[model samples]
Target: MGYKAQFHPGTSDPSKNRKKYMDPAYKLQKIRSVSDEDVVRVLGHRQPGEDYKSVHPPLEEMGEPECPIRELVEPTPGAKAGDRIRYVQFTDSVYFAPISPYQRSWMYSYRYRGMDSGTLSGRHVVEARERDVEAIAKELIESETFDAARTGIRGRTVHGHALRLDENGIMFDAMQRYVFDKSTGEVKYVKDMVGEPVPAPISVGKPLSENELKTRTTIYRADGITIKQDAEVLQMVQNVHWERSFGGFEPFKEAKF
Candidate 1:
């Protein structure tokens, strides 16, 4: 092959983690299991076994327009079934959480289809068909990317990513959606993402060890893996910035890599 695809650049461990997460080919290691029904309950959108309410008819019923692009492309199962759009939002602590909002968007774009993502200061929200969102949420919750104490599933009032952790070692939640069980040493969610009470609390399993977080995290920090250490990544960023500046000012000049 002339040119193989490269996901991200850097020799640092965090940089390597960034590449692994963004590559669709890499299967995220599963850390725990939460039932599909439990995921539905945690979302608090529709109860388990409830029929999916739709804004438009299924594609099979109404049929798509006679466009060549539409003919060539296949719709997601949710789109074909006319499932309503739903969202799942996650808040990542700045204390070396495995993945952050920007990384989540990159990973999601690489791994999924028929979805839209919004990244903010503290949260990353992915919106897709209801069932599809549920599936994605479940996988993310049970994966190594999510530390029960660090990654929060918050649909609203997301305001604690930058704050210091509590004595219990869990990130602060304004709504107190989850609590660290002192006895079991597990993080359990008592409320839904939107701060609504769930019928029963769901356990997302134990938090990862500090060493594990340091190894798997994509964040570049002075205390951990700093960006300055990754010379390749830093140079690439500078090159891209320089190229953009030169292109904006000297449109006629041939750009250099």
Candidate 2:
């Protein structure tokens, strides 16, 4: 589903009540603020980063727009037509919340380069702690979604809970070179040297039904620092996300996409 931006306005303090919006990127990552009056005044413009262009001034310059909503989505449960909200959707369900809507044009430009490519896809989750790759691999292995023997990104194998047949998967890999200091037993690594993994050789073949396609297909780590691959139920995996993470969107809360 497309991202729908919602504007929330306030005078006392916008930060105190930022949780109302569903678009977490603006809140968690961007930390932008919009007032209610701005939402009611600005002309309707696509939020920055959508395939369409916006004529509005940058957030820094304009402070905030008239109407808070930027992107659009269908009204969600318990939501009214005039509700100021951001909507998060996956499959057939939509969730609504109030949040500051910020432009993501720069990110979209880098991720979807083709003129025909518009709209963002995918979502990410913010974890409480950094996930250990080795632990994640162990979980995948235990779950039995991927064969432990066949799975290895840059010689580092995933051995975690396996993914379920009905669930979609996203993979990210960071390949790095390290210099081990013999005296201190410490490894120093440069952030610039990290890169993406090579594409996987095996592909998930076409399933018998649409349900199978959605259930069996998964995204896997591939070469390049930013690019990963998506494997459909019937098609071979291809390069994707040269500039973004899996699912194209960031996750709010722990809910699965």
Candidate 3:
């Protein structure tokens, strides 16, 4: 029999959300629309109409040795074209953000190929071929995984995930990459992800309401769904903690709750 993957363990909304986000079969809901040109501008890797710079000659053009592994493995579009590697970083607010950095790493692993992801305390960065990274950034920006208010696309100065939300309920960006538009009731990016100015403001749509955020949030909070409330998740956490703490010294002993 084929093995079935259990993405997560719990019945809570956050747990369910984590599982759903990790499952590649689940199509993430599109909550907003950001133009492809705007996506390129915000990535700050290249100009809107600029050609992708290549680190090496295209696979077909390069005189390559015939290896069995290379024959069996299919190269991604960017890889085949020998595009230079680039990255996109996202910071998720702790205050009812739909997704967190750790989960973002897991989701990216399941959903993407030919890329590497790193997770920090509050930020996640995915590195891939230049064009591939741009595609990924655009999809994630438009998907439910991103909230215009709670999620930030920051290439640097990623220090606002743990801070309190601003008066407009937007995540505090020290770079001030994005601003809340009062008249349109939307969030617009005046600068690129790395803090350079863009030609025009790129609107990423309005912020989700507090109630909507709560419903979609994958974070466990005392004010909402606490981890303590989910026995299965709590048990899993304890088991992992025990293994990491004592498994090295007491390899033969069972963990006691």
The top-ranked prediction according to lDDT is: 3
Which lDDT tens digits does candidate 1 get at residues 31-145? 8999988899888889989999887899989967799988888988888889999999999999988899999999999998999999997899999998789889999988888
Model 3 agreement with the true structure over 111-214: per-residue lDDT tens digits: 99999999999999999999899889989999999999999999999999999999999999999999999999999999999999999999999999999998
Better by lDDT, candidate 3 or 1:
3
| Superposition TM-score, candidate 2 onto the true structure | 0.16
The sequence of per-residue lDDT tens digits that candidate 2 reaches over residues 129-231 is 1112112222222321222111222222222213222122222222332223345433222211112221221221111233332222232112111112212
Native-to-model Cα distance after best TM-score fit, residue 68 in candidate 1, in Å:
1.9
TM-scores of all models? 0.94, 0.16, 0.97
Cα lDDT for residue 81, candidate 1 = 88
Ranking by TM-score: 3, 1, 2
Residue-pair clashes per prediction, in order, are 0, 43, 0
The residue pairs in collision within model 1 are none
Question: What local lDDT score does residue 177 receive in model 3, on the 0 to 100 scale?
Answer: 94
Candidate 2 vs candidate 3: which has greater lDDT? 3
How much lDDT does candidate 1 score? Answer: 0.90
| Sliding window of 10 residues with minimal summed lDDT for model 1 | 248-257
TM-score of 1: 0.94
Worst ten in a row by lDDT for model 3:
246-255
Better of 1 and 3 by TM-score: 3
